[model samples]
Target: MMKLDFKNRIALYYLMATSVISILAFVFIYFMVKDTMYDSLDHSLSYEARKHLSEIAVVADTIYFTHKKEWEETEHREVQINPVFLQLMDTEGQIMDKSPNLKEDHLVMNHAFSGDTHYNTQLKDRPIRQTQIDIKQEGTVKGYIVAAIPIESSLMVLSNLSRTLLGLFPLTMVMLFLISRYLAGKSIRPISAIIHTTGRITKNNLGERVPLPTQKDELYDLSTSINGLLNRIEEALEREKQFTSDASHELRTPLSTLRGTLEILVRKERNISEYEENIRKSLVEVDRMSEIVEQLLFLARNGQASDPSLQQTVALAVLVDEVLSRQHKAIKAKQLRISMESNSWGNFEVPYYYGSVILENILGNAIKYSHMDGRVVIELNGDPAGCYCLVTDQGVGIKAEDLDHIYYPFFRSDYLKHKQIKGLGLGLSIARKAALAIGAKITIDSELGNWTAVRVSFDQKVS
Candidate 1:
């Protein structure tokens, strides 16, 4: 089977509809013309019948023409142009006078026809229209008169009209199809433009957008939707590129440090104490690498859809205590002051692993970045709106410009560039991902050399 393109399909359907309408119009026109021609023929035969009946006179018991010579005129005799035939007969159905045009072909008297009825019958092997009119004398039947006329010219006119309509049908349809196809092509030109623009776009070049039409129609909506999709794809690809670059840089530093430590240890025959020291140093770098790997794996898992099976209601204040306990050593080493206000009125339901990762990252960052002898405060509470946990740290705070990008992976602030802070910059990134996966919101408020407060708010249902 041959397939039609969109443009051709539109044209074909329009043509099919047009063909049906044209056929009906042609049939109506043909019948109307046919009826008009036959009506004129009937009128002419009636006029002749009335004229011949007037020329006759009924005297006593006999009936004859009042003017015999008037009935012998050439108009009634000639058969060149449309000729009229006339005839006369008595009630006994005897031979009657007829038009010279009829010659030996006399009009047949139908006794079955009683009234002045007009009908169609054959005359001398040709089609003719006839009618019978009864002549009366004082309500007594005297004789009958019949009149007929040929119908060749009327039939010829009808036949010509039919042939003209038949000849023009296909031609008119072809013209209509062409016009419809042109209009359809103009209407859908924007779609072609969209296909072309989108075909040239790829993962590496997703900046291209489909052009929008001026009319705010369905096609305009389609173009806007496609552009929106392209925008999302481009943003995702950019994030992937940044992640790959940052992961490579972060992994290389640890491997290089471990390789350097091992190279120095095997350079000479060191004593057991020295070997132990070197092994311990190498192990610290290996541990750091393993931690980074774990964080990266957790980040990857957070990108997936959350599983409902892992969800459980947790006492948020108790969870915060656990996270703070895990970072006890760091807090103790810094000699930081800790304060907690646990006013939590509800238990938040969230995925266990996600909740753990989010709270740990935020609490760990609070402890890690705090100054020695600095104060760290944690507050867990719930309101009618939702549940919230806030961690405020008196730390080397982030700059205003860097706050917007703090959740990007491996995006450490420049303020901590030369500091002795130990971090891989994935903490906030993991925290944000975990928070988002469990339908929570994390907001950070920080100022340079002041304080940074991280707030996590859970949905009302979970609260």
Candidate 2:
């Protein structure tokens, strides 16, 4: 079956409910009337059957007439002998007495005894609901009294009832239908209001919220969830707008600088060495601008840059070893003996491309900051609460106050803040963002003169 929509579903529900109730009511009335009417007829038939039997009582093996309530006082030749109908018969199949409706004194083919109490015989002209009963005398089969009454009254009552039902049925159904329609509308008003409110809201017009239905039913719950979803969407939209504005501001100055430097270099042709030096410096600035733009794009995209095929269940222990070994070139070039520790649960089920990038940035930062021939203890493991990759480098570490600002874009440690560091101070920021995308948290602990230990922990439990 095809599904019914809400309006029709409500209509059908009302229709079935009313139909059941109406049928029960009609059937109850019908049965009650029939039973009560039959009881009254039965009582009258009992007396009539008893009286007719008494008149045909047996006396000395011969049937004698007794009761004569229905006998004529005088005979008149002109007046038609009232139809001989009521009769009484003997056990030997002899009729002793009869009303004027009978043809002979005894029954012809079939006989009814006095004791025949209650039974029916049908007639064709109309329904003839008749009853026959027996009349007995002193334990002997005597005679019968068949008391019959035409079912004219029952027919008339039923005919009237049927007519009344025919006339009233359509009107009752119409009334019920109207009642159902009204009820359905009343029940669905909240839904209609919700639709109206929802129509008013668009992507650009998320400020409008649906009003909770006053009834506080299912509609209220629906409204609350929709409103919460809209709130999240609005927040995301605002973040995008802010990013667009900040990106323009951040890119504008670098582009102008690169343009001015290129213009100056192109104006005059210098000798090879001088030209080479100037061009390298100019290229460095250009590279800085390029890196900044790439970082901004990377931040904007977040994890959208990840290739789905690169995702795999990787061994974190092996990853740590690989990163340490890879960073050995940069590690020794920076002149630091970096230690290694491994106790991951054991491997990370993640993408390899993004994982390598995350490790390179983190480890590269440690090597860059480490002192010449200094100790950089790299612990790949932690106790209990999940795995850890801790890199504590012995170098001019972060100032106590600058720790919080270190992860902000273009923010550097006080020592490296003024110096021409290779990065625009976004390596830690990018590493933290990538960590977040893959479900990890980064923590930092440092002192001005001691060491800077950056911990990228694979948290045992997710918040």
Candidate 3:
């Protein structure tokens, strides 16, 4: 299992995400306020510029008018306190009219100007920022008017805004860090519980289950499923323990009987005539034990079918013939007549022992469960899909409801209870494993009246 670092990384990610979002929001608002403030400043400067145009004293002979001294007084009062101050330069390169608070310097070199623009000039011995505009009548530039407004207030507003944002940013970052930590704890609690419970389940501690919640959210559902699996694993381990004990007990009886019988037969003066029969019975006992041991090893090895060396080319006909030959005695005694179905020999590349174990299980099941005069039929066919092997027997078949569980370990049909069958219900389970190891499938079709027919198919074909 992979270990997860649940606290620091989670908190960091949450904090980072929130900080990014908050900073982006702050930036958006800052720009909007900046544009709005600048627009208001520019509008006020332009409006005052238009109003201050009327306060100008036009001192030309053709444009002579009364109230010249009043205009001069008005310009002095208007320019002293008003925000928008104006400076007028003549075409003769001289200072024509300068407001009361305005300077005559820095206005030496300038030409016709219009629209809106910025310039820096020394006014009243201070550098003043100015926006220049031209007064035009009948498509001619009369002169240029430079409107100056102090940018100190705007700079103050922006500086205060920046300070406020900088101050709030750190505070908000701290708040977001705390919030991320809290949320990470809430979200990762279930995982922590799962980890703690999993840690408690060490070797031979299969009985324990993962902690779960009642809400059945995604994590809860996952925990619930794992708990259910642990229960099954616990039951399976318990059953395996019992099976080992049962097998030991079962083998001891046969071995003890054989030992006693052999002791009697080995007496010096006794059982010279019973030597062959005694040897036969002893061999039978040995054979049965050997079979049981082989089955147990098969069960153990089935879990690791990913071994690379097991891959091979298996001829279906050759495998079937081999299994049949091994059961020669049983077949002959039962007078069983069998016929193979394939027109030509076909092979499937699969695990080395796939067809061997599969045929052994099915055929052995047929032989063990068949009636006095029952027949077993086997057929192999190739279609567009790879190939299939079908085993049909006249023996008792499984019921519909019990069919699903028949491949589970030690799972046998109800018919086996009354019939003379001697198996621990591992043949079908092993067969199913072998089929899966070879990337094949086993499907059963049977009824109460007729016998069972198991079809094994390798669905994908090579040449």
Candidate 4:
């Protein structure tokens, strides 16, 4: 099938509807005109028949015109140009007399006609409208009178009318189609503008937006929707670019440290103990790079829908214990005092890995940021609706301005930078992704030089 543009399609549909309506209208008009012409002819024929019937005198079962001079009048005797024909018949269905206009073609008496009945038949190879009625004298049937008039003139008028309408129909439709196309194009001009504006937008030119119409119609809504979609695309592209730059910088730092260590070790012959120390430092750098790669891959996976395989009924107390065990070395090194308060039914339905990642990152950050002997409180609560955890740490807390940005990938606070925390600033970002994938919420509250609190809330009812 061939595809038509919007304007042509609209015009074509309109033309189809108009054409049908026009044809019906023309047919109605033609019939109306034809009926009116027949009426006029029938009226004239009746007048002629009555005029001649009045001149007849019937005496003793015989009928004859009383005035012969009226019959000899030229106007009544003419045969051409809308002439009327009259005939008189006796009781046996016989033509007694006829108009001079009919010549030898006598008006045939139709047996089917009885009284004042008008009908149509052929006369001299031309059409004629006729009416027949009986004559009476002394309460007995005497004779019949028939009246007819040639209808060629009226038929010719009807023929010309039909031809005119048929000939003008195509021309009228053509003109209507052109006007409809023009109006249709005008109505849809906004769509063309939208296409042109969007064609200019690209990855590098995402700031461009389609112009909006002043009238708030469907086209305006469409333009706004397209602009909204473009805005989302632009934000996503910006995030992609930032992620690429951050990943490159983070990867480069480990590679550069490894290269510097190996270069120094090769500069001189060192004792076995010294060489072992340098090799161990290089291994630490390799481990940091591996951790960054693993976190990046986890983020990518969680960006899509959460994995169903990892979803299970997890006990919050058990998960917290596992996370604390992994961070025990840091907690002991900082001499942090840890406390736990949890409900007995502190179980949540969530992806297992998602719950693990959220707990591990939050606990690790609490341990890594706490001061010596500072209290790290872990609380858990649950109900039929959901379970929640709170991890509060007395640490070099974030500034008020940095609290909002903690979930951004590779976003580190000025306090963490100065304190030289052993982290790549990805733990909270990874936790945020995992929490969102599991339909959980994480919130942070912190005061500079006071304390930092992180809350993780999970819904038990969600499958």
Best by lDDT: 4
Instruction: List candidate 4 stretches off by more than 4 Å.
Output: 1-6, 35-85, 90-93, 98-105, 109-126, 131-145, 212-225, 265-276, 296-322, 325-337, 344-356, 381-388, 415-420, 433-441, 457-463
Model 3 residue runs over 4 Å out of place are 1-5, 17-32, 43-82, 89-96, 100-116, 119-128, 132-144, 200-243, 258-284, 303-318, 333-336, 339-352, 365-463
Cα lDDT tens digits, model 3, 80-137, are: 4434565676544455665554443344334444467554455565544566666555
For TM-score, candidate 1 versus 3, the one ahead is 1
Candidate lDDT (C-alpha), each: 0.82, 0.66, 0.70, 0.83
Q: TM-score for candidate 3, please give it.
A: 0.64
RMSD of each: 5.0, 6.9, 6.9, 5.0
**Sliding window of 10 residues with minimal summed lDDT for model 3:** 61-70
Question: Candidate 2 regions off by >4 Å?
Answer: 1-9, 20-65, 68-128, 133-145, 150-183, 186-190, 203-232, 235-239, 265-294, 301-311, 325-329, 344-358, 371-373, 382-384, 395-416, 459-463
Return the candidate ranking by lDDT, descending: 4, 1, 3, 2
**Candidates ranked by TM-score:** 4, 1, 2, 3
Alpha-carbon deviation at 285 in model 4, angstroms = 1.8
Report the Cα lDDT for residue 214, model 1.
Answer: 98
What lDDT tens digits, residue by residue, belong to model 4 across residues 126-215? Answer: 788889877888677799888888777777898999999999899999999999999999989999999999998888899999999999
Candidate 2 structure quality by residue, lDDT tens digits, 1-463? 6797787678777877887788777767777887777676666667665655555656765655565545553221111331223555566656655554333332232345224344445433433344556555666556555555556667679778767766776678778877887888888887888789888888788888878877677879998988888887776676577467657876787678767767877899867887787778778777777777777666665344346565554666677677778877877676677667554444543345555667778788777876778887777665567666777888778888888798886678874453844556778878877787667778888887678888877655421
Q: Top model by TM-score, which number? A: 4
TM-score of each: 0.75, 0.68, 0.64, 0.76
lDDT (tens digit, per residue) of candidate 1 on 234-275: 766766665576668778988999999899988988899988
